[model samples]
Target: MAFNYEQYLRPGKLPHIWCPGCGHGIVLKGLLRAMDACHLDKDRTAVVSGIGCASRLPGYVDFNTLHTAHGRAAAFATGIKLARPEMTVLVVGGDGDGVAIGGNHFIHACRRNIDMTYVLCNNYIYGMTGGQFSPCTPMGDKASTTPYGNPDPTFDIAKLAIGAGATFVARTTAFHATQIDKLIAEGIRHKGMSVIEVLDDCPTAFGRRNKFRSVVEMMKRFKETAVPAATAAKMSAEELQGKIVTGILHREERPEYCEQYQQVIDRARGA
Candidate 1:
């Protein structure tokens, strides 16, 4: 609230549609704060999102915003960054939109090392269509689709980003507001592909079904489970299980996709 993020928000979209106690708003604010902190030019920034409760954030921000097709936000952002390499492109999407149907695109984007920042809102359930289990949903978690419980192993998106060759990767929960802002800012500043996997809460859809009594309880759980990378290094794997390791998990300097393409163009023109 102290931050002047409101200035970057679209006044016409005064009222948002997210359910009460949902953590998407917190993630949105962190992104805006990061944008302001990084001194990014709003006019030169493009905010891309896909279909979902969390994806609606782009509609509220005053930028070159694109609310693209379901599970295709990253693909759309890829095209934007390729065309306007000078512009700062940021992507916002839910777990379902980013890693479920769009998982392949997400993987390739990281592998390509395109210059962009992606804030993947992982609420562990599909909050838009229904409270169904998502790719990040923990095992034994019950949902509308998984009445008995989710039997599939959950994905740690940070590891996926690292394995896929993303140059920057980090994770922070919505409750860690200040930390998330810093991570987002760093992700924006990184030259290659960066992904900040935000452990956001969907109180209305996921919390109600996952034994979370209230939003406060859900946020408190994140604080209880989160361990910084430095601290996690000392803990045993058994002790670290079920804990959310929050911070910059991976970073490596790599040739960015757009810049690499420009080299080819420069060579072709000379020839």
Candidate 2:
């Protein structure tokens, strides 16, 4: 039986604009499924995105969606969650949008430990604005800007989120569809800031330049190399080299930003 995603999607948006082999659609689908899994009130959920291929997600979803400026989805989500603490705020964006231009906001959001979620679609390259080497682009990877190869070391997105003080952090690839939904659902249930890094594919731009023969090859690579966090812990660094770590990396209870601020206001009121 086909899973009907029409209810979550906006009307008259039947045909999405994503490319044939793009994995952003799958990430969005997993997010919606996670929303359902948590039994969230759709009316009270707000989705925000920055300018990029993955950022276009909010426009097609039926929710309080904001298509914001480039690399500002985290900032927008922080504001929305603060203004309406009852609402569930979710920020979606690509690697370029989240870590390149928006790195400041991203780190600070995690530092704040706000009651919100950030779903980062790390496709390695800047897919929409031609294939540019993003902050997450692996060393020696080819992009339009890096004809010879990208020399800069890649950012481990999950580690960055943890280092920045996110209460909850997880990583998964497009191949791990069920894991994506499971992690996002858990993130939503957690009270503090959560970062879910989804290593997705952008076949048209990233794939062609990186020498991926086909979408199948790209997906097969993920299946072979993605290691669970628990398993990775036992393996030596040399043994786990070139492997993508999946599963929840860090999680801890924290006084969410809004609640802490509210307490200060109440104390000042002397009531």
Candidate 3:
């Protein structure tokens, strides 16, 4: 009862696969803390993930975990939530898996407003599959796929979710560990679909190529660049460039997909 992580951790996988300085472990810790804070039933919870360094989270958690194919976490999570309406389904993955290859699914999931939660670990690069540019990778950043500089525009994940009809959306960073945990806990408690975009770090893949001295330095940069919601509202667009805005971006009431489907079933049976 004292927030025992061992109760929710997988057996025979004591040590994680992430690198020493990787932020994935930090993100995982935040997620576990969130679950504990929410007091979610371990047996009734399902964590679904796609193929990526961060996607390895589902495997380590002791819940009903599913390790799905690349860029398919949202799709798999959707199915899980639809089938098991009683379960608290959560989706976890990296920027590459959630936004790059899984972009379509992500949008559809948001539009459906299913009762679920999505935690996107945005490390800016494809850490597991080599140091490649990801959808959330900042413009002009250097990566193995973008040796010179990335030409594409980066995604504002919280904004996208808001526009796509997600009932709840929040953004936080691994640097703000406690905030991330609280955001995840609140998102999970919300009824409709919620998204928590956690900006993490890939020291090996992203930091080294970008001239960051160390993980601590990168985290410091995150702290400096981050702007709180109240502060961001007072700043102009010009002043907000390169700034990471973190907080609850949006929240609204909506009917969950599965619940609506059940209503239709009830109507048909009555008819």
Candidate 4:
């Protein structure tokens, strides 16, 4: 049977703002499927996003949604988790919004081991904001601001999440459409901070400037370059260059932030 995505989507919100061939819609469907698999009550789930092309996702979903300032999605979601720890809070945004501007908030949230899910949609370049180069852009990619080729180093978001103490971390590309929902559903079920990075394509902004002829070409690259985590482990470091290791990269048990905060309250009452 076909999944009834319409039940989770807002009526009259069709015709999203993403450009033709954009993969954000694919990721959105995966998210909705994950929510359904988890049996999450729409009223109890809060979806938050910052300013960016990916951040506009919450506007189309039927849930408690927050369209916040640029690069502040993690921070805003943290507050929501602290105030109502029982509610399922999810943060969604692009690479630039999550790491460049919201880097501090993102790291702290991970460090605290907050019980929330962060879905980072990485399209390499700043797709909406003038095709600017972002932290995740390839070292030598072309963008509006990097016509001469980007010189900055790229960030490994999954590695960053693991190092910063996220209890659950996973990565999947848009090409692996089926895996997106599975990873997201696992993240939602996890007890601590969960970061799922989705490598999607922005054909209009990132692809054209980088010389990708079409969306299919971009997706082909993902299919060729992605390595499953199990297979990646047996490969040599040299063999793994330029390869993205998808699947759950890291996961560990930890004390969730809200639960720890409640301990403080209990202690204070006893004092």
Candidate 5:
């Protein structure tokens, strides 16, 4: 049976602002599917986003959504989670929004092990603003700001999330459409801070600057480079070089921040 996505979307929110052939739309569909798989209640679920192309997602979704300031999605979502512990909070943003300006907020949320899911769309460049190089942009990649080629090292988002204490960390590319929803559903089901990095494409911004002829060419790169975690385990370090390891990379049980805060309140009352 064909899944009906209209129920989860707002009326007249069509014609999303994303450039043609951009992968953000693909990620959006995967998110909606994951929401359905998790049986998320529109009333009880809150989707928050910082300013970016990916951040525009919440505006179309029929849920408790917040289109917050640039690079502040994690901070806003943290507050929402702390206030309404029962609500399922989800954060969505691009690479620049999640790890550049919002990097501190993102790491702290992970360290606290807050009960929320952050879906980071890593398109490698600042697509909406300008074709600026982001933290995740590959070294030597061309961007509007780095026409001479990016000289800085790129961030490994999954490893960063795992290091920062995210209890659940997963990664997949937009090319792997089926895997996107599966990983997102798993992240949503996890108790502690969950970060799902979706490697997407910005054809207009990143791709054109990097010499990708079409969206299909960009997607082909993802398909060629992505390796499953289980498969990666069997490969040597040299073999895994430049490979995007997909699937659940890390997961662990931890004391959720809200539960601990509740204990503090109880102790204060007793005192």
Candidate 6:
């Protein structure tokens, strides 16, 4: 049976503008499935994104949505959730928008333990603004700006989120459709800040210059590099050196910022 995305997808938004081999569509599909599984009310949900090719997601979804400024999705989502604490808010954007340009907001949001979900589509390169090396871009990966090789080390998004105080943190790849959907659903169900780093394919900008050969080759590389947490635990640091750790890295209860702030306000009024 074909899973109809029509209900989640806005009418007249068909034939999404993403590149042929781009994995944003795949991630969107997974997100939709997760939403369906969670049985979340679209009317009560808000999807927000920043400026980027991946940030175009909010326009295609049928929900209270926002297309915000570059690298400010987290900030915008934070405001929305605080003002309307009853609503379910989800922030979607690419690696550059969330990590590079929006790095500070991302950390603060996590630290506050906001009641929101962050979907970070990490294609390694800045797909919208040409292929520039992003924070998640591998140490030696080549982008348009890094023709020879990237000198700096890459950011581990899952570790960053966990360290920054995300109540739930998961990592999955576009090729792992089922796992991606499950993680997103779990993230949505969690009360405090949740971050799901989705490793995706940027065939045009990143793939072409990086010598990935083809989209299949890149996906194959992801599959080869990814290992489950249970399996990874058995392996030594040297053995798991360059592998992508997939699955829920961390999940725990935390006090949401809005609730804490409300309590402070109530106490002040009582005093």
Global CA lDDT computed for model 5: 0.96
Task: Please write out the lDDT profile of model 4 over residues 135-210, one tens digit for every residue.
Answer: 9999899989988999999999999999999999999999999999999999999999999999999999999988
Off by over 4 Å in 5: none
User: Which is superior by lDDT, 1 or 4?
Assistant: 4
Tens digits of per-residue lDDT for model 6 on 1-271? 8888898999998788799989999899999999999898999999999989899999999999999999999999999999999999999999999999999999999999999999999999899878999998888889888888999788999889999999999999988878989999999999999999999999999999888899999899888999998898899999998898899999999899999989998999995
The TM-score values for the models, in the order shown, are 0.98, 0.98, 0.97, 0.99, 0.99, 0.98
lDDT of 1 by residue, 1-271 (tens): 5778778999979678899899988998899889999998988999999989989999999999999999899999999999999999999999988999989989999999999999999999999888989999999998899999899899889999899989999999999999988999999999999999999998878899888999999999999999999899999999998899999999999999999999999999995
Cα lDDT listed for each candidate: 0.93, 0.92, 0.92, 0.95, 0.96, 0.93
- Give residue 157's lDDT in candidate 6 (0 to 100): 90
Clashing pairs for model 1 are: none
Clashes in each model (backbone N, CA, C under 3 Å)?
0, 0, 0, 0, 0, 0
Residue pairs in steric clash, candidate 6?
none
Candidate 6 achieves a global lDDT of 0.93
Encode model 3's per-residue lDDT on 1-271: one tens digit a residue.
4657787788898688898889888889889999988989989999999999999999999899999999999999998889889999999999999988999999999999999999999999999878999888899999999999999998889998999999999998889988988999989999998999999999999999999999999999989999998899999999999898998888999998999999998999995
Q: Sort every candidate by lDDT, greatest first.
A: 5, 4, 1, 6, 3, 2
lDDT of prediction 3 = 0.92
- TM-score for model 4? 0.99
> Per-residue alpha-carbon lDDT of model 2 for 104-127, expressed as tens digits?
999999999998989999999898
* Model 2 RMSD vs true structure: 1.0
